[model samples]
Target: MKPEPSSALFAGPFALATLSTPDGPEFPALVTPDGQALDLRDVFGDERLTTLDVLDRWETALPRLRAVAADAGPARTAVTDLRVHAPVAPRQVFQSGANYRQHVIDLHVAHRAPGDERPEGERRAEAAEIMDRRAAEDLPYVFTGLPSAITGPYDDVVLPAWAEKPDWELELAVVIGKAAHRVPVEDAPQYIAGYTIANDLTDRATVFRRDMPQIGTDWLRSKNAPGFTPLGPWIVPSESITDPDDLRVRLELNGETMQDESTADMIFKVARMVSYASQTARLLPGDLVLTGSPAGNGMHWGRLLRDGDVMEGTITGLGVQRTRCVAEGAA
Candidate 1:
């Protein structure tokens, strides 16, 4: 018989919990909805469970724990006062760009046509007009960000003094549960431990300049600014997010909604992305692959982040994360 939906919903969110001690190394802890934190590393030691040895094992463990909780009910201790950390301190962070269809169309229109006899200014104007027309159409686009750009859940984002066009992208990031190479689309879910919220910060001026002939080919530089990728709050185990592709994702600057859309709008589904990524490189345990963001980002509207801006990003079923932006030289 198939498991009940409620059983799935009870699946715990993954996180690394650290005690408020000044000396010891923080260990991996599993979070329970009732607010209980289990020191899995302490309990399991350096054994297989200490780390999610394999994706399938992690998936299997969820239902097993949920069943135990269901049986224990009133006896199950809830972890209410634990401090949450990033689910996984990954060795690498992989990001996607121009994966959204709307973004692709916008880019194409921005550049001059192959053989069209149009002046540079005319092409720029036409591109702007095209972007306005497609405002309502959510297109898929993808790009990558360096792992060094990553910061923890409550970490502050340092807005560099040189960044004249700082912007934020609210995206859902998938955590790899095992090493996978050439994974098939249908079997991709088996490799994902869970999902979390990610803010893909960008320096727009530097990014745009890279497209010009003079500067040329510096995609990594435009994205790897310090504190550019703020991730976490917690990881919502895959089993808990019944339909990841259908969840609502939104971003708010201060208190105003800046980006709001559903993962259903993604041109390339999560499974496909996993499969595609695996074809070129081996996705090891704890690696993060941030799915592309939707429309309404500040960059699309010619707006840029300023000092003291607070950004909150959330994905339905996953936890919300808040970050404050500090100017480059600010102490």
Candidate 2:
């Protein structure tokens, strides 16, 4: 909690979060803008209702959630007093890679192999040209992520011993509201339930199959480790965000700002990414679509994550997410 003001926790009139008391089971909750968390078990009239269940019938649940948020009684508890968890347990995760215009160019130049002594300016110009062509002709580079990689916003991220170059990629996560199959980009918005934040942690050492160069990137090995994706403190309704393309996505490593870019830098916007994903597979309620991370990852700055590092990430209108890095076998 760090004594940060409640206003920094969420935006709009209200947001949805998963929370639990010290010894109680985790449950869905409606969090007011002022930080009061009202458990939705009684409101839903079912103790077994999870956030996924609420999202399954988002159209019907929205009105009820709004009504509760508007007049949450004294039965609510302060959010600071409860243990926060990931907003929802997603069944599927679609992650977009190299989708940021500037981020890709930066990665291209920074990751030059040994003995490649081309000037930085020339390398950057070449990278920019490649990015421009990709935007014009190639579809977004989207990959599937395991839901097991997800962890709470405030949870500890255990950096495995094998991950020698762990890095951070803060992104805007699109939470699906309805089932979508082969949907058009124009109709993608209707399937969106809301938005949240996700930090897609990667291990640079495992990024490529060094033994098999033709295999290229290995996302599953580099990014799907447990606690690799630190998710939301809450999910802000899509209506609350005036423009998903205009939000600011920022991340700080141990109190130092590292990634501070805008969604405008994304090569393929949220709607297009979602629509593209639907073309290949059916998107169900509670599925997460992670828009690519903007520039300024640890590799770009030569400052990979280590034990005891703290990452604080926030997206405009979505809430703040803070996670502490812990060594795998730490006490």
Candidate 3:
């Protein structure tokens, strides 16, 4: 079971959401200023007011939504009264790879390939040097993930039978609000919609193809599995978070703290990641750019996911995600 958060919700600006219900269809709602929620249809007097509707007009809708939230007092529904679903259905997902200092360093020292015969200290130093050079010379490493892999924050993660080692990667996901192609770092923030938390679950056993080493990594087979990415409970506006580079990302597995690190550890920051992503592909509204996962993955802890295990991931103000793991049946 996931424990309740210690902090309050009204301290900042959060966006709308689509809710899950038992009796009727899913509905869109606003996260009011008072931490309560209001039906978007009622607030806007338009039944077609979906979270996507709000996102499509994010720049103009923000002021109006903020006003509604501010004025929404006693009449608002308690957030606890409704079950929250994924805030928005993203059109695309871009994941960063080997972008964390500690994470990559850990991998280098752990995997004793032909060249990894160096001492642990030497390996750490080498990895640090490599990151420094990459930041100065190389562009960010990114790859596409199927949007269909996304699921609700508190949903169950059904582990496929073919996956022998499923790992958890808690990352800060940036949601784009506008289109950008080949954008500069200075102008990247203008394209951002907000921030959300995403758990980029991966099948470690299939990351690299054993049969065909020359073809490189098989990210599609290792990643992109259904319900592999668990997204937010809410999306905090870009303005709400003062510094994207200075947030804490944490994940606890089955009541034990596993991955806990600062966003400060990212090799490439948000602006650079967004800018680099737009260099080739056109980044449209509602697309997700997942900043790479920080240190302390399952590989570092020597334990991968299993049935009935609970993963609770929190990224500063973005929100918490509690995903219960279950094994897939042969049926």
Candidate 4:
């Protein structure tokens, strides 16, 4: 028997709206331009949707979305008019580091190499300068954070008082759809759910200062601050992205272009990073992997974000996001 077709409605970047079902938000898929939420699980449930499961289904989902759009008539203005939210509200956000050769060079010039091991006093004195200088050099870097830091589309990023140097990192983030660990590098693409844009907010001064041996902890303290990571506006299905690695990324501050580059600059590519990370831990559905950012950050200009500063970023084909920086004490 022919099965009923499934659809999705992805509005405002990462906002995903699925069809109403007895199970509740069936498929929980990403929204589309035509006010339809691609019902991933439903599509997988139906034989007519396709034989492929979620892991390998994206390749087929694109055409399916277009077909649905054709049947729906011209897309509603609301789908194109809404704001985007984080592609996936995951349990955690994994960020990369020193992944770009240029970023490594910048770090070397500002701070010592990984093994250089500078003296305590010297390291402290150079911390701020290193962050400032390194920000100028668009070297590849990575890191990870808890899910609490995750913010939805159009959410404001709070600049804490302890953060003397709050900076922005505009990056491409990947969402995991399948449950797989230690997946071979060649097969890494099979585990992906979709993609989105992310702004990795950093507390530079606090991070370096806490790196001191006297602190007595291995983890970087600067990373734990509240509202550090702002993500979303939308989570674009992998099928929607023709070439994930080739997309162009841009960052604008108060209407001024601050960062512009393509994902082609990545030093560690997505497949390798996914394969590497999965080897140690499970990369489950809804997990977020943030690809590193390109050069051109405020830290490089010695002009970290101030209260009320508007920051925006966009990726070709995916979508754009704008955020306002609120002061620590503001009501």
lDDT of model 3 at position 38: 74
Which regions in candidate 4 have their CA more than 4 angstroms from the true location?
1-30, 34-70, 73-77, 80-84, 110-142, 209-211, 214-220
Q: Please, what are the lDDT tens digits per residue for candidate 4 over residues 1-27?
A: 011122433322333332234343323
Residue 60 displacement (Å), model 2: 1.0
Using lDDT as the measure, name the better of candidate 2 and candidate 3. Answer: 2
What ordering of candidates by TM-score runs from best to worst?
2, 3, 1, 4
lDDT of 2 by residue, 1-331 (tens): 3214565566688888899888999999988878888888888889998999999999999998888877736388888888899999999999999999999999989888768899999999999998889889958888999999999999999999999999999999999999999999999999999999999999999999989888999999999999999999888999889899989999999899999999999999999999999999999999999999999999899999998999999999887899999999997
Pairs that clash in candidate 3:
182-278
- Overall lDDT per candidate, in order of appearance: 0.67, 0.91, 0.83, 0.63
Could you tell which candidate, 1 or 2, scores higher by lDDT? Answer: 2
lDDT of 1 by residue, 1-331 (tens): 0111222223354333322223545555555554555655444454334333423356556665454434434332233333344555677677777555554444444434447877656765765565555434533233455767877666778998888878888888898877889998899998887888888887766774534667654567667886788877666667777887887888999898988888887777788777778877888877888888777777565567999999888788776678889998898
- lDDT tens digits by residue: candidate 3, 1-331: 2224334552275566777455756677777444566787776678766776777788888897778766736376666666778888877789999888888888667655565567789878888888888888866899999988998888889999999999999999998988889999999999998898899999988998878788889999888899999988787888888889999999999989999999999989999999999998999888899999998999888899999999999888776789999899722
lDDT of 2 at 257: 96
Model 3 alpha-carbon drift over 4 Å, by segment: 1-7, 114-118
Candidate 4: C-alpha RMSD to true structure equals 8.6
